[model samples]
Target: MLFPVALALIVFATSVLSGVFGMAGGLVLLGALLALMPVAAAIAVHGAVQTVANGARAWFSRAYIDWRSLGYICAGIGIAAALLLALRYRPDLATVCIVIGLTPLLVWIPRRWLALDASRPLHGVLCGIVGGGLNLAVGVAGPSIDIFFIRTAIDRRRIIATKAAAQVVSHLAKVVFYGGLVQAMTGADWWLVLVAAPFAILGTQAGYLLLQRLTDQRFREWTRWIVSVIGIFYLGRGLTLLLGA
Candidate 1:
């Protein structure tokens, strides 16, 4: 009972964080879930919860979503999902953690090298392909997807909305990849995810409200530092576990 309650709280808190910042919340949630559950199960549950969070975020920011880009990104996501399904890859805690930990480094890449813009059809497809595969592999891809948008001329809200829209597809692909393709989720896992859904929605709403208060400059700055810190912690944790293993 206490465990479920705690998990729900984490879901709510992280969703709110995601709602405001657009990406860090999922990274934090995936790490917490990975710590508590098996890698496959953790990714599956994270997918379900984030599906709701990102879906709601997309809806909230629907006015700003670049629908054309989302369509192309979805195409790339389908390709990536099919490729991952064909490989029948399995996930382990250490590797997944390492992958997740390394993703934030994308935020620090030289701006010139990251000229990828999601609004461009080809770039959107690439974002979907790489970001979707990474999301399936590690259960999160906030920073990876952010690279494409960070270089774009879009405003903060569009970045948040479009990313949320793209992530909805990516996260759904993850849920299917791990939950159905990998056959990882149990009935109890589904139940917990369902219970956490409402809380996620609430958190997203709260975060969206808060997002209205932040400046574009502050949004980008905070996203970089926060994700970097989280990435460093997870990197250390993964290394320690890998060494022990």
Candidate 2:
């Protein structure tokens, strides 16, 4: 009971953070979940809860989603999911952590080479495939996805909304990829998801309201620093575990 209560509170807070920051919620939630449960259980439960969080954010910010980008990205997501399903491949924890740790570093890639033209659909597809594959492996890829969007000229709201929309795909894939395993884990704690739903909704709304105050430029700047910090954290954690091993 206490665990559920605490987890539910986390769900609300992370959702609120994502609601305001438009990213980082998954990483925050994933870290918390990992500390409480095994990797498989953490991934599934994170996917389920994130589904609500991202879904609500997307709906709230639906006006700003780049439909063309979403279309191409969804196609790429389908392709990646199919390949993963056929191969029965998902990376092990050490690998997932290492990769997750490495992604934030991509932000440093020189813009001359890394910059993506927002009007192009192929970029979205490619990013989706890569990001989707990684999401399956690690359960979240917003940091990587953040690198993709920060290159474009789009406004912060659009970036947040579209990314939330993309995350819907990735989070859903996490559930489907870990389908049976996730279901089995949730068989006992499904109530936590139910109990946490409303709080998640409220939290997203709260974040949305908070986002209303920030200038677009500030949102972008803050998100970049926040993502880099998160990357350092994951990188450090992954490194400690590997070195200790």
Candidate 3:
């Protein structure tokens, strides 16, 4: 009884944060779920629940999405996901932890110094492929995608909308892939979905409302801080995994 209630609260909080920051929910959910369920089952459930949350957010913010950019990024994500599936390369947990932990620092240096040219399809496609792959491995790929999109001159609303939409597509793909891998859904999995779904929707709504109230500079600054914190968490988690501590 208490477990489901606690899980729902965590889901709601993470979903809202993800909605506001454009990412982080999956990592939070994944860490939480792993403690309660098997790794494979947790990933499947997390992917499914996140898909629902992002799908709702995408529809709610549909007017702000940059369809053209989203289309190309989707294409790249589709291709990359398919290839990764075909190759049967499972992500190394320790390596993923390390990469995710260090990704913020690595991305920050280039983001600060380099003049990004987001107008190029090539750049967008590349980021999409890498981002999509990372999503499959770790369940959160927003920071990389956000960094790429930030290079473009698109408005903040459009950035959030487009990112939400792209994440919906990515998570949808993951749910399908994980479902196939898991074979049959257990009773507990269904219960998790039932328990987590409503909170996910509520979080999305709260996030969208918050976004509407923030100024552009404030939003950007907030996003940076969010990314930094998430990166640190990822790095610490990875190091802990690598060191078996």
Candidate 4:
């Protein structure tokens, strides 16, 4: 009972974080779920909860969503999902954490080296492919996806809206890709997702409200630092786990 409540709170808080930044919340939630369950089951449950959370975010900011970019991204997601399915890949906790930890470094790269603008069709597709693949492999693609949008001229609102939309499809693919693991989930796991659903919605709404209050400059700045800190933590955690093993 205590565990369920704590997880639900985490869902709500992380959803709020994602609502404001459009990226970090899923990473945080995935890490938490990984700590509590097997990799496949964690990804499955994370997908289910994040689908609801990001779905609400997309709905709330529907007006700002870049539909054109989203379409291209979806195409890329399909391609990545099909490829991963063919490989039948499964990640361990250390690998997932390591991949996630490294993703934030993409943000620190000089914009000149990778000036990816998701508004363009090609870049959108690339974002979808790489980001979607990362999401499926590790359960969160926020930093990878963020690198594409962070340097764009798109305002914070559109970035949040469009990313949320892209993630909706990406997470759905993750759930389907891990469908076997999802079937193996227990009733208790499903119940936890059920309990987290409404809170996810509520958290997104709260985050949306706060997002309006932030400036574009601050939004980008904060996203960089917050994700970097998280990356460092996960890097240490993954290394520690590897060493212990």
| Total backbone clashes of candidate 2, pairs 3 or more residues apart or in separate chains | 0
Model 2 lDDT vs. the true structure?
0.79
Q: Which pairs clash inside model 4?
A: none
Order the candidates by TM-score, highest first. 4, 1, 2, 3
- Tens-digit lDDT string for candidate 3 (16-118): 8777767766667776876676555666788888888888788889998888778777877888888888887565556666666665563455556655433
What TM-score do all the candidates reach, one by one? 0.96, 0.92, 0.90, 0.97
Residue-level lDDT of model 4, residues 115-161, one tens digit each, is 78888889989999999999998998967887788567878899899
Ten contiguous residues with the weakest lDDT in model 2: 181-190
lDDT of 4 at 5: 91
lDDT of each: 0.88, 0.79, 0.76, 0.90
Off by over 4 Å in 4: 182-184
Best by lDDT: 4
Query: Model 3 Cα displacement at 88 (Å)?
Result: 0.6
Candidate 3's C-alpha runs over 4 A off are 110-112, 115-119, 183-185
Q: After superposition, how far is residue 178 of candidate 4 from its true place, in Å?
A: 0.9
Q: After superposition, how far is residue 185 of candidate 4 from its true place, in Å?
A: 0.7
lDDT by residue (tens digit), candidate 2, 1-245: 68878887899899988997877777788888777777777787788888899999999999999988888778878888888888877545666667777787766666677767434688888778887877887877766676667567788888889888988988888887887655447456667778888888889999998999999868866776777788778888888888888
Expressed as tens digits, the lDDT of each residue in 25-98 for candidate 1 is 89889888888888888888899899999999999999999899899889889988899888988888888878
What is the Å distance of residue 34 in model 4 from its true position? 1.0
Give the candidate order by descending lDDT. Answer: 4, 1, 2, 3
The better-scoring model by lDDT among 3 and 4 is 4
